[model samples]
Target: MEFRILTESSDWQGIIGEIWRFKGAPNDRNNPILPSYWQFLQIRLPELPETPIPKLATLSWFLREEQKRDWVDHRLVSIDPTLHVFSPTTEQVVFFWHGRNPSQGVIHPDFGEPGGSPWYDERPRLPRLRVEPSVVSNPSPGHLMPRPAFSPALTSAPGQVRKPKALSIILPYHNDPSHLFVPLQPFPDTRHTQTKTFQFPSRYYPLRFSQSNPNHEPILTNDTNEAWPASELEGLWLGSYGPHGTEVLYLHSPEECRINAWKVTGDVNVPRGVITWRFHSRYQTGPECIPPAAGLDSLPESCRIFKGSAHVCGTGFIPALESWIDCIVVVFDRDDIKVYWESLRHTSRYRRYKGRDISLETVPNESDSGIRVPPVWD
Candidate 1:
């Protein structure tokens, strides 16, 4: 979706307040632009199999649910605006910019997960490169960066069938060229929408909103191999580097949500991290948890909260349990919760929740010992 900021401003709320004065640029008449945030964001049924889960709320009531979810729309990680070239393959989203500043560039993997066991593979496998820029321009919105294009070492027979390769493209913050990781033609698993559980190879690193045992915390023993936890973490995504290195982002799902939380087991790297630990959902309705001082602490003291509009009336509503829907985006280190966006329903008088609402208490009570599973396949 293309969003041409009519009047760009970092203050999102302020722009929202002055929406009455909003107008799309005249040059972009070919695109459908709405007068509200609805125009800035687009919603289409994800290209995935329909879930069989029963719906409790009516479609007419779903608008109010969306509004309640929008309250925290700002909390979602922002995609860099300078990114003009977006490469969405079966394996990952590769972004390229011609003149983007690399120094200020930081690739935020939609799926960032650091420090964990071999969720899929243990030993480090070399990255594969695909997608030859010289041959193609404007690849389909979600197309695969075929391996043979980039990697000469790839060996695939003429008639014998081969599995579709998954690619992970990694590059510096700002660079004209990018690299891809196309594993052996047929990786252990190549199903794009398929999700699985895996463990971290290390102990539960401290991440906020996660529980930790004081006694089991890593100690600075005299052993030379025992390296203490990292104090400064760049960020967490669905994929992680090997025991010593990092890779480009490699995750693709038109319909998928990844969640990760830090945890410790009797053995290191058995299960993946959980998004939220059990805590009281009810708060005092004031400044709740004190923000942990910026340092080595991995946990986020403040879990993100999203609120949207009225599903029924298409009017605004207060933050209520029924009004707020819960949607979680789990990766390797950080887990983000999203409530749906609100809109007016065709019918209905009362408001309703659009999606699900997640809080400490509302989070599912799944076993923390088993391998952490991706929410999409679940």
Candidate 2:
């Protein structure tokens, strides 16, 4: 067994002396002197006289002589210091301390006696001490377990034709048609048509179509009061009325709107299926433009642009309108747009400032247009 001695002090002689005082009376038969202590004394104190004297008797004589000469305090010498020993191999711990027994004025059962002064060996041989060796081995191949085989029927077969998954459409405000309608500037020729050309309050503007049908005219039908003909309805389009320089437009349909559609063909590099749009005031300014002053409270009243995209999915016919609609539309308001923009800006700015070892305790106020200033931490 491997033994380690952990001690708070390096005064070995003081420790030994402390152990000797409580090592029991001189006539006790069951003396607690341990084999380890005998080995320690043999190696550490070979200069002691070889005269035969009982271990307890020698210790008593030395202690008395020191006390009489006032060389050491008898009271201090009687202290029983504890020794902690640990055997790693055996996983055993032994705490040895010399003290008087409660039942009889003798050494405690757990303490070991100091080795006697006149140590003698009656037997020719002492028991040999050896540490048992630990064994380590790798698991055998026979013990290895194999993974269970999966069923081939559960996997797709070669040359199998997989059906396209239906895209899920989340309607804004429970599929309210009023929310889906987007207004746009009238066509150029309609500028003087005398049919309320500039602002058709009752008509819903159609910004895009699935197919390029020039024959399809923008006829304001009294029955539906729509700006465009029903036959031309084919894809999806997002439109917002902003100042000339800040207009944002997104159009997607079966044919003409394909350019704006995010194509998902199982490739990771390409954005697929569902797409979302949210208005962020910060990015409204062009790249070359500087951020406006923070004191500005609100956006320009003239720029009352409705900015946001409606989610659309699948192709189906609306029984109520008796028209075929290719996509479902979901719209969001200015409040939703503002919230999204603020959250994104806060997160991005936090990461950037943190990387530069700067504190973002107080964020700068947004400008009049509600556009947050880009953070630049030194």
Candidate 3:
């Protein structure tokens, strides 16, 4: 993940956001992502100290906690090109802050263990940001203004849109590392550093996370009340893409009887944002069934199967070189989603995306996953 500069002022403060690059797979799409500020912080951290850090915006900040999270996830997981697997991460971001010196016994222990110590034994700890209510803010000219790379995801809840604004949120500062500052900018300004030093893994600092929109509905199209069993698969899934890597795919059953496989992440051959393959429930009829490819087992005996057409394209995805190929699909629980392309004589496997990196809330009425709760970080 990288933050690209969108605009600038006298210093590193200006419009900025993160971008995810595109990687291709076997079944590719036409959308080649160049630069995308996919989201803007509904609530932002107080800026870290200003510096020459290109991707790392330098500014001072104060942390706060919000009883409610109006935030969303904006993260990307890079699958190993050969291993065909994604690295798993915990929902928490941990780092060290404040001084590491041992505690003193001057103050009352009622406040904390070693109330006398200015810093809590100073070790790595999990940080949470909570935006307090009653904290309205005005945009500051000295700080970086955030702009969405694309349009920011702004719905605090499904069907209810929330507007982005400068918030004077406070991160409660305890006697130790916690800090609560008003006006929403980093405390103790450091933009005037004369040394001009540039280094990383700084003495001790922090890590970050961007939660997916807890409220945005992600159902492709739910026209019917009782969706097909495939509707249970209506979330993020990863499809195998040969040696290039494992590309991200989203399976949504629309029109009640058909399943459409759309590329959430793809490589150059099939970039992303287009349907790779889809099948109608009506076509899986008749007694004769085709055998599986890619050395996969033939019988789950009771799983649903479908015959479909897989979309294909050349290396660069030239419009004229695009065509559809015969393919078969398999749905064997959440762990095994498979697709076999007869033209390539290969079968691609899919599974529930392990990357909790990013995702919007599943559509409420369109899905049956139960009430989705945002991770409790703040």
Candidate 4:
């Protein structure tokens, strides 16, 4: 009844990648250093009872899935579909975006009228599913979809638990985290040999993605920041901040009032899983929306600014000198977004991340050096 863990990176280069479970780091943790993204990333399965969810036996099944030949043999690292939905518990890492704040009662665009009313609690609640061993015809690889009728691995109990706890999804850009709240359409492809043998229905829904919202046109207003919705900046974005080079970020709006930026990959100072910055409307009506002409000339003439705060920390996040600095988001249409940290006194640009094709292509032939084989756990 536990959801297993895998390396944040899907690569096979040494110990940077390995499959693990709920237990903490192995003793002698120095051997295989866990990826920096680990702290910010964890997946949980639903407590729903009716779903024909099978116990995903960890190691032996992974070995059986391996068609042994060479250590260099390349294989597509497919994510376990069951790990998509994130059930946030009190013991788990509480994300700022997951706060129980009042939302504007928005719904996914695809859900239409029948997609049901917004949850009374005003948080995202993916539909409880009734899954069957089915194949997705021309499914978008790695896309999470749901059409009220079913989900991939978990099923809903009829008239019992009406609203399952909504989950935060983890999408990796080569170990850099990303999340999207599009729509969940069930496309279970239980076709793998071992999966078929064990009757494990595939939950990895392959989705067609768009790096840019070609159809979206922002509407500017005075009182309401209607231009800034959860879906407005909802995708993988690449941005640069001072010495931290270019890092990946995932943007989600927990409520209409704020857009939370979760770091997927970042510098030694800030690291992943932290809220790098978020946008709020308090300063939008003030003089702050008018961009300071100093270094922000690159932004288009048509830009709207929403004020926010940036997270600052020391190297390795030491001393807890964390400061919430003032910042602003310049929304020059949907495709082009920029940020200026007043305290850091710097400006940066952002764009949608068009994903790259990667393979977890290699594992060390000898186990003596890199990562010592972890002892079997209960």
Candidate 5:
């Protein structure tokens, strides 16, 4: 079957907000705007399949200039249900966290147990380079470098007899050419017994300073540095680094981490209010624990460590929403996740109305609690 690509304008802010709320953002007194420890990508498949297991080939995100493309191989990890109990929509959404399977295609009987470990691998295994040198216009600014033309040969893995269909998507960017999400630097070399803490000004948020709004002021005014307790950094954190920023931080453990940073359009300093921390450890397993590296490679066999200088935005911060879009495109076998997709796609309003609401609602005197109410006219 030919590969099919479905594109949509992702409500990333709203989605992040919903996930934050699901993780107890309202009751979080410390940092209400802070996101939880776990982060997820909700995929709405084009068509539902009959089988329970959805066949996803790959998932990719068209990011800012520097790290032009971020791709994940399904063979490395599979998408599973989100840790949180709440979802914004009635669409039977399936949440998938970030991590890799150490066993490499091996299925665990428990499945839910920490079946596979997580590791970062920057090896150039794919047929095409994530950052194509041929299409790069300006070598100075990484993000502005154009992506190389796509070909079916580039998409297929080496030695695979059957080739999957190829689909190329062109994502639009409205912000300045030089400003892009700063790519995470390579993890510093360290011995197994050593514990190193590296700190740098994060370029997660677009630099948008307003002389009027004090709330818009950056936490890192100068080159000031702050030491964060590893224990305190357990949950998800949503904050900006630049003058204007939108970024997600997922700290599964002291060793494992995942981040989603973007230079979005508009004066929105940080999505869903200011930078804050949301604690949701109950919903997450610690970062994938990888065994120690024995040989030359410091990291495990399939893992790669990322640690480097933080990124910063270039000039030209546009306030138009139509200028850019946050999108995630997945190439999966048509059959994978079909049943779940169909259930969500075809869910009836009446059935949703009949169902009880399990989301937490804040009351005047009472603490935030999950309130179940029948669907009705406001």
Candidate 6:
């Protein structure tokens, strides 16, 4: 029932307003959020609001609205964390763009109202860098840069084979607290026991855990000392790379199915280089299943179910489990995708930059139940 979006730049308030407008309600009665942009997000699927979504709350924002004017300049609402209400079995959490500018693009009517709206000409598309098609033409002299020289052993005999680049991709949540991947007998935790057979709630279920019992605190206990956290992860991103475009990517899965994660696979053309991705996943699977793999041909690889723990306690001592992989960032160059796991890594330090905020939740629908889609956002 919670959602969040992280950004390097601040403008969170304005982005909130944009999301409201996309829902067909742009201005707030007292304070308004403006001058924003949201290109990435991480949200829970079942908690998306439906036909008549109630009040929206901001759990945490980059800067307090009370202290600054146009905090949008340097301080943006970098991360937006909110718990929402929705019918679990009835609605699907969709991630789409929101805006009032025709120059920007379009807006969805059902985003807020199905037909009741001063609808824009078109709905806005998710923000993203477009990838150029691979040109088959001959490379110019300067463009045809030489590949880095390989060790002589690689070119030794006529029958010798070139080795594939060994990419030691680690999707770590926190800087590696490297414990030898040992078999632990379910770290004496009760949450795992209570959630052992808990079925994912259907969309029609109106009452939320927080709503039903405000007294219920997310599992909090001290193994060595004391603790605290929230349900959604903040500062989330993805990372991956392959020798040629990415041939494979392995990331940790979510501990629970409560939140719906996202990943976009395409061509990301930066001034420095190009990142092309052939596949992306928004998969929900168990720890026992083999980790899912994406095929190079665009077909999503089946989520590999496996048994393990990648759970971290968030703001309220809430156990944030990787029920699903949230967002995957893929960078592409000639034939390789430079995927950075920054999204997956949990760093204590904060990075600063200038930009707008984006606060769109993943609205889940019944039709999308158990279905996996690529290009989740843009």
Considering only N, C-alpha and C atoms within 3 Å, which residue pairs clash in candidate 2? 32-113, 55-117, 296-368, 298-368
Over the stretch 1-378, how does candidate 4's per-residue lDDT look in tens digits?
112234335432112222221223433211112111111223333344477866432221121122454543224223322333423211111011111332111111111112121212243334343322222122121222222222222111112122223332322222211111112222322222122222212122111233445665554444343544546666666566554455656676566756777665555567554678887754574443545642665544456777788888854443445678888777765555777777666777776654422232223334422222322222
Q: Candidate 2 regions off by >4 Å? A: 1-161, 164-210, 216-270, 277-378
Better of 3 and 4 by lDDT: 4
lDDT for 287 (candidate 6): 26
Ranking under TM-score, best-scoring first?
4, 3, 5, 1, 6, 2
Q: How far is candidate 6 from the true structure (C-alpha RMSD, Å)?
A: 25.8
The top-ranked prediction according to lDDT is 4
Give the per-residue lDDT of model 3 (tens digit) for 133-211. 2211221222221322221111010111221211122122112221112111122222211113410001111111212
Candidate 1 per-residue lDDT over residues 127-171, each given as its tens digit: 223432211122231222232322211111112121122222222
lDDT of 6 by residue, 11-96 (tens): 33322211111111223211111212212222222344676766453332222221354424332233232222321121121111
Question: Which candidate achieves the best TM-score against the true structure?
Answer: 4
lDDT of 5 at 125: 22
**How many clashes does each candidate structure show, in the order listed?**
48, 4, 37, 11, 26, 77
Give model 5's TM-score versus the native structure.
Answer: 0.19
Segments of candidate 3 deviating more than 4 angstroms: 1-228, 285-288, 292-294, 354-378
Runs in model 4 lying further than 4 Å from the true structure: 1-230, 286-294, 298-301, 356-378
Q: Which regions of candidate 6 fall more than 4 Å away from where they truly are?
A: 1-232, 241-260, 266-378
What's the TM-score of each model vs. the native? 0.16, 0.15, 0.38, 0.39, 0.19, 0.15
TM-score of 3: 0.38
